[model samples]
Target: MLTKQDVHVLRTLLQEYAHAASLPVNQEKQRLWIKLNHLHMERPMVLIDQIPWNEMDVDGSLRCLVADTYWRQVEDNLRCTLYKFRHMPADMVLNPYVCLPRPIHNSGWGIEPVSSRHIELEMGSTAPSREFVNQIQSLDDVERIKIPQLTLDEKREAQIIQEADEIFSGIIDYRLTGLCMHLGIWDSIAMWMGVENCYFALMDEPEMIHALLEKMTEGLIDMIGQMNRQKLFDIHSHVCHCSQTFLEDMPKENDLPLSGNAWAFGLAQLFTSVSPAITDEFEVQYMKRVFPYFGAIYYGCCDRLDDRMHVIEKLPKIRKLSCSPWSEREHFAQVMPRYCVMSNKPNPAFLASGKLDEQLIRDDIRRTIDAAKAHNRNLELILKDISTVNHNPSCLWRWQEIAMEEVQR
Candidate 1:
């Protein structure tokens, strides 16, 4: 449902990729096309507020040697705008998904390095120390001298074929760009398994947290079967970002095909800073066993959005369900009238204070288009970036002309 010259040729190719990211050899393809150009489109909701939050380390026990030189200057300004967006072809821009290498999950899994010099060598240790989980189970680039290529199993199978070639190159650019292909790379493997070992590990030890989340979901299905053996891999779009931590029934039926991926899923609920009855006992029982491995699914991400609106009112083939910025815009316009497509984020300190206060950003874009035009459906507002906010890019080209005049009146 995106007409109007396909949102004016995606707001003129995201304002000529944000004016070629303030030039300088297209600053790493304008910071990975301004944070993965809304996952190269197909209703991949983005509002824009610039958020890196010191490259998030929710519990990997910080100390990325002074934040890996500002995350390699935002991955050399996103591989200089993906080598000037011929969608990455300048000698495959060092393709390992452009920039890949990671580890530091309790020092690549043996657990217990909660840092600050392992809390001053476990100060008054009482237990929970087999030499502090065997010195955070395996970290050797000379005892974890800040996790550079310690070859965590061949750089996690080349970062799962560089995140399955960004969802098989966005389903081959959504069949030559019809649009709606926003892949987030399964929350970048849940930020390399450190959202508290991907959510509390069955409250810490349900058979050693289901044998380390089933050997990290069988090394994420052998890095998504080497990202479905690269070359053009099938294209079905509809994958969003963040959310996952299951536990309740703890996947038994032959661990639901190694926990998810048929294609199409989305969730946001950033573990609501824990405790909404432990985010409904481990984020709604491991996302109801990864919701039928998806056709489409979504839940909140930024603010609890009424604690995952009762698991987005039981998502089956969810089409889009965020309301966040701490939802309740008239109870998400009366509970997302007719199950799905709401989005509506708006609030990265009101688009990062570069104050052009066009009557307070056109009265918050006319109260989010009169609250999603009386909730018939489909709204879309998202200006994210919750931590270390910083981006403005003329408030993402003036909120794409105030979200195309509130999704066309």
Candidate 2:
């Protein structure tokens, strides 16, 4: 049961969402995004994310006003969506629909970190100092990692959607979005065994590392099958892994459900110092187990992946290549194939500093633009990993202004 206040707040947010969805710009954006993803863009597209969103403003514009805990999350999402478009509106598309997770929950991998310590420089930082008590220290320890059992609440799922439709009828649609995966086989393993423990094992205990990854990879592949079997894969989902999915080529007539339309995101953040040969042997090899199940794949993250593009580009169904702040612009731009979109991530540290250094932002974006032009490759600016903006949200507005100008040029 919603309180009068909850009803008022939700209704107000829905009104704005409906109005925004009706705007002509969304249709225009959807078309451009499709062209960009197809690697045939007339110009570049720009977007910003990975924000410390909750702390963007002290003015309470970013504050959660709803009383219910669950509803508060809905309120937060709505506020951020409106705040984002109102401020930047840089190539972001809004729909009259909001996607909700399917009513599916799971019992996680049975093993837990035995011991760990961590400290953060600031609240809400995604990175922090950490240590772990290596849980998988030997060959036998691989058995301790268990596959999570999944449960679907179909009755509850129907109930919630029906209720949402009843509340927001004719105003907005509440659609259910299903699971798309980012293969984090290595990330989970690194935490169970310490990060250094895993890396050292690559050299010191290569056999043990291989045994662990194989077991972990098998479990994840199995999980994907189970999720698909439950009819929980949503390929047309608007947002995927912090980026947008523009094309909607769903499974044709009898095509395999996920195999025809689904996507898999692949990355190994710990491969910073590892060589291309070792990365292929460990990360890429295991990831290939599930690659055939998806029609396309987006690969890489914050860790420097430029040096090893030759290795990953050969992986099956490679679509988008993430160009991180550390990736060499000219080389990656030149070498990245025309079939894939180079998603260049600008350094958010420029925005994180005590004050905005406008010149640094210009230089970074200009370098990316130049690199893309030099190679005649299509590039998209995805400014992310933004942990802070010194409590001044206006910096993002400025960034949008600067980046939009550069990309359009």
Candidate 3:
């Protein structure tokens, strides 16, 4: 259903993206990051804030694409890169191509869908609150949970792929990419049983909690097995949790790798307030079931892992750990040196105040740099979870400038 205008818009963006990809600097930065991830000598890297786009002053013309899902996706990717080019300091590789198969729908899960009541936030509130309608009220509900089955529609997939190929035949390469998986066990269960219930279950119904975790883990393992059998897993590089880490042992093109050769990300932001012992029992133990399937692990998110270093330290495949704003800077600076890349997440709240506080931002960056240097930890400064820029796009650009200057200093 693409009109002449739609095609024109797409071509313009693709050409611009292609030109950006062809830059030699982008390739050089990519090589540098690869070296850094491998523990080779390099300067501390910085990924300009992973802005929350929902809170930004997005351009109106691009917003018009929302009416068409396919075009909207293309627009979003192009818009993201365009913004990065204009402001962010992260490495920008020029190849604008991405391979994704037509969506494969899944059904037949043993557990019934959990319901929740979404509550709107009051004016000025940052995030909306939700009340979980507990679906697993007792032990019997645990037994009802079953493994899920996945099915693919080959004919539909072929059409979708063909359409994508036709749309960008000469503009950009659009090929099929493999399946990517993220295992969020505790968070998934908390949604069904409620976060409070999960905490209480650890004390009152320990056995039941164990049973549920076992079932969920088994279900996830089965899903991975199914994906592998279908040759759905792809060789894709992601940076969110792993911080420029790549899979060294990826399978050859058209071949598939077992979970042990693939990259996996796991985190439990929901368990941040729990004791390490409780976290170990409920979160880490269950995660172990799936972690063995991946070649490398990227752990942690917004949670402060300063106190639970001992627990995560045992994860053999961990290559990067998110040292969020709430994390103890000195503790991570010490422990992460011996473990993995410190994915330092500076507070984005400094920008959320509607004006750029250059001095405060520089001071914060200096403290992190000093701490990481003290212990000789490989650090990747990642500014993320940005809720707002108060409609000032220049705030991000200035922040990136300040970050690069501070890091170079």
Candidate 2 lDDT trough over 10 residues, lowest sum: 251-260
lDDT of 3 by residue, 1-409 (tens): 6666776777777777777767787777777777667766377777764565655545553344533565667667676766677567465444446545446767755554355776543444345466676777678988888888866677767766766766677877765655556777776777788888877888889888888889888998998888777756545544435255543334445445456556768888877878989878888887877877776777888888988888977666777888998888988888763658888898988987669878999999999988988988877788777766776767887888888888777
Compared with the true structure, the alpha-carbon lDDT of candidate 1 equals: 0.41
Best by lDDT: 2
Q: Model 3 — which ten-residue stretch has the worst lDDT?
A: 242-251
Candidate 1 on 261-364: residue-level lDDT in tens? 23334443455565565554534444554455433455556645554465446546555566777766657766653645666676656644544565676687
Candidate 2 root-mean-square deviation in Å: 2.2
Question: Which runs in model 1 stand beyond 4 Å of their true positions?
Answer: 1-239, 242-318, 321-337, 345-353, 358-364, 367-373, 376-380, 384-409
Please identify which of the two predictions, 1 or 2, would achieve the higher TM-score against the true structure: 2
- What are the TM-scores, per candidate, against the unseen true structure? 0.25, 0.93, 0.89
Clashes of 2: 0
Better of 1 and 2 by lDDT: 2
